[model samples]
Target: DAGVTQSPTHLIKTRGQHVTLRCSPISGHKSVSWYQQVLGQGPQFIFQYYEKEERGRGNFPDRFSARQFPNYSSELNVNALLLGDSALYLCASSFSERPPYFGPGTRLTVL
Candidate 1:
């Protein structure tokens, strides 16, 4: 079986722009989560959705949002991108609340 998958392996944007990152979970998975990894730092949990509903959220601002689909794939949208927002966006999936399998992540660079 395949692990989680993400799209647009890399992206470049300017400050104040908006961006959307995508993810597809492994087969039979129903929960998806998003994380932000800044250089030299561990991934910071951003959101977790189960059964297409939001179950948890992190300390990020309202500019960050996400949604899980019926098929369990998910998308993370960030508005008003900032230089500080440049990071690797990772997606993880699991059957339940247990540890999740993470995707390679979408690297975003803000100028």
Candidate 2:
């Protein structure tokens, strides 16, 4: 009964590079979502996947994308990374649209 898990706890990349983040949901969960948290600010929703389909997305640009697996795991990808992309990427999972349990997050640093 894990909450949520994200890999590569931290990452470093240069501007214009691409990075991928991974997430595994809790047992019995069917929905997974991604969020970005800049230092000193609240997390901003990025994407929501339910049953391996996208259910919602935030105001992020096309550089941000994500997909969920049949097993309820998910991956978040960012293209053309910018210094502004440095943030904590969080993964959340739940049974429905309600509040979801979040993972520790992957810290992305764009140099």
Candidate 3:
């Protein structure tokens, strides 16, 4: 079976620098979600997109946002990032609202 995939296993940035993470959902999947996992913490939902439209979002600042493409691929954009924003960004996919299968994630480090 096809599996969810994410890019750049690691990233490092400054306190005010911006970052972008990418992901590709499994074949036949229509929904993609973004999550943030800080060191030693569970993943936190950031956004969910289905059919190229945002379906859900978590409690994140305006600096965090994401979008899903027609092909079920996605991009997470973070702007004016803060040190607190440093975390592992994960991408997940599911056929329904049930628990999703996740990617290995892009670890973001902010100085």
Q: What is the C-alpha lDDT of each candidate?
A: 0.95, 0.96, 0.92
Deviation in Å, model 2, residue 91 alpha carbon: 0.3
Q: Estimate each model's TM-score.
A: 0.98, 0.97, 0.96
Q: Rate residue 58 of model 1 by lDDT.
A: 96
Alpha-carbon runs more than 4 Å astray in model 2: none
Q: Sort by TM-score, best first.
A: 1, 2, 3
User: Taking the tens digit of each residue's C-alpha lDDT, what string does model 3 give over 25-110?
Assistant: 98888999999999999999999999999999999999988988889899999999888988999999988777789999999998
Clashes per candidate (backbone, < 3 Å): 0, 0, 0
lDDT of 1 by residue, 1-111 (tens): 789999989999999999999999999889999999999999999999999999999999999999988888999999999999999999999987789999999999999
Please give the distance, in angstroms, between residue 83's alpha carbon in candidate 2 and its true position after superposition.
0.3
lDDT (C-alpha) at residue 11 in model 3: 93
Q: Per-residue lDDT tens digits of candidate 2, residues 8-79?
A: 899999999999999999998999999999999999999999999999999999999999988989999999
> How much is the lDDT of residue 69 in candidate 2?
88
Candidate 2 overall lDDT versus native: 0.96
